[model samples]
Target: MIYTGFMFIVVGIIVLFRKIYLELQNIKIIIKIFKQQFSSTYRNNVQIKKQKHLTDLSNFIPLRSYKVYTIDQTTSLERLYMLIEKAGKTTKFSFSTYHDDESNKNYFVIDFIQPSSSIIINVEISKISHVLNDKLQELLSIIFYSSNTIYTWNYLSFPPVDFLIYDHIYSMNTDKINPKNFISLQHQFKHWYNRTFKHDENCQQIVDFVDSDGPLCSCPYRPCKFPTDTWSLSMAIMYTFHEHLQLNENPLEQCLAITKLAIIIEEGRNRQRIEALRSPSIHT
Candidate 1:
């Protein structure tokens, strides 16, 4: 009987140690997976240049000049001359020229400056709708690649619409649409959160406690999941907007929101990192 009891105790010790060992191993595996995923988002160093030149042509005269220019002239000088002529006597203004040499397209920024205010127009070579759609797809692609790993890790039962939200943000900024629409979209996301986890008291409590400008506190019951794609999408949109608007609430606020959302998700899971590894799908 003594020998049997001793054997039972020994077995119990071994089982406990095994469980601890497995837990430690799981933690290590998770960390390793995260590092592998994180490195994939920025692995390729593609030297693509999307240059925008701000030209102060306030002193330049429109079509009255002796310079013979063609309507179809693709050269930078000819295009600049055409833009000046198109302004039609407007003075003291700023315009932008964009050259995407990779795509071989010319884009223009037509800004009219009155003494009191300024209005800028995004004049693309293509139709505005087409340009906006292309931008949205580009933004979505970035998010999709960035967050592919998180989707696999969680085995998400259904595809989340975070990518859509990302596209919306990019569309709003790149297409130069009214910012009120973006604000409305943000509110809509809050409403969706409310509906998705209405039954969970903890989630409801968290949602209720969220401040207007406070870091987004996701539903605790379902818990907000941060895939690498979500972060990439947010960053890409924020970075793109930062390039143009330089608005008071851009890039910084957007980046902060990303970081905060990640923390909230991580805290809810009692996990160290909120974002899963960058998706293998991302082209470095």
Candidate 2:
């Protein structure tokens, strides 16, 4: 009976140790999250200052705002430019030929700065609704390699109206349309943002968040699941305004550039996973 009682005590001790270990792991995760958030905010504040400086420079001076990623020889600029062409004629988007000047890197900008009206347009829904699916699929193809993965990591708050509904609205009333009519669609997309972000209301915060660096939607949002595409299309729009029904001129170029950026990010994440596997002491 004494031996059985001693075994029970040993088991209780073992269980207590396991609980402590799990709690410690949880604390570590929380610490890491806070560190990342703080780091991001600091970088954003610096970028905002830089953006103000660049904005006073000139028009057509490619804003230093495109997302940058690390790429080696395998990710050659020539090869990437060719891929952009394969998607569509790269010239349509005014994609400069891949030059190894080292000063200028391969990138595409989507923002339009109207000096007269002082209106800066960042993200816009495509008026051509049919193309939305194809562009999104093309983007997903390079990032995930399969449409199947889209459902697994659903992060994009895509525009609500399909081509048919948009056409119906256009035919019914082109003159005077109320923005309030599309309230339902806005509500539907509220749940699609990353980590319980209130996309509809808080997404407006993105207006001031953009500058020469890139769109900073990190205000209330945790790291977005699809940061490559979603981060580039940082500012969003409701279908209420006529201006909302527009997209970048060379949609394919922007899509292709974002895909390349996605590749760099995934490769980094992949390396981290491999390193974690090698280091058994390192809790992932």
Off by over 4 Å in 1: 44-284
Q: Estimate, for each residue in 182-281, the C-alpha lDDT of model 2 and write its tens digit.
A: 1221123223333223334444334443221125444423334333443322132111100111233433233333222232233343433433433324
Of the candidates shown, which would achieve the greatest TM-score relative to the real structure? 2
Per-prediction count of colliding residue pairs?
5, 2
- After superposition of all CA atoms, the RMSD between model 1 and the true structure is 22.2
lDDT of each: 0.34, 0.33
TM, every model: 0.19, 0.20
Could you give candidate 1's per-residue lDDT for residues 175-272 as a string of tens digits?
Answer: 33221212122333333333433434433234454322223435432333432122232322222112122223322222223222322333342211
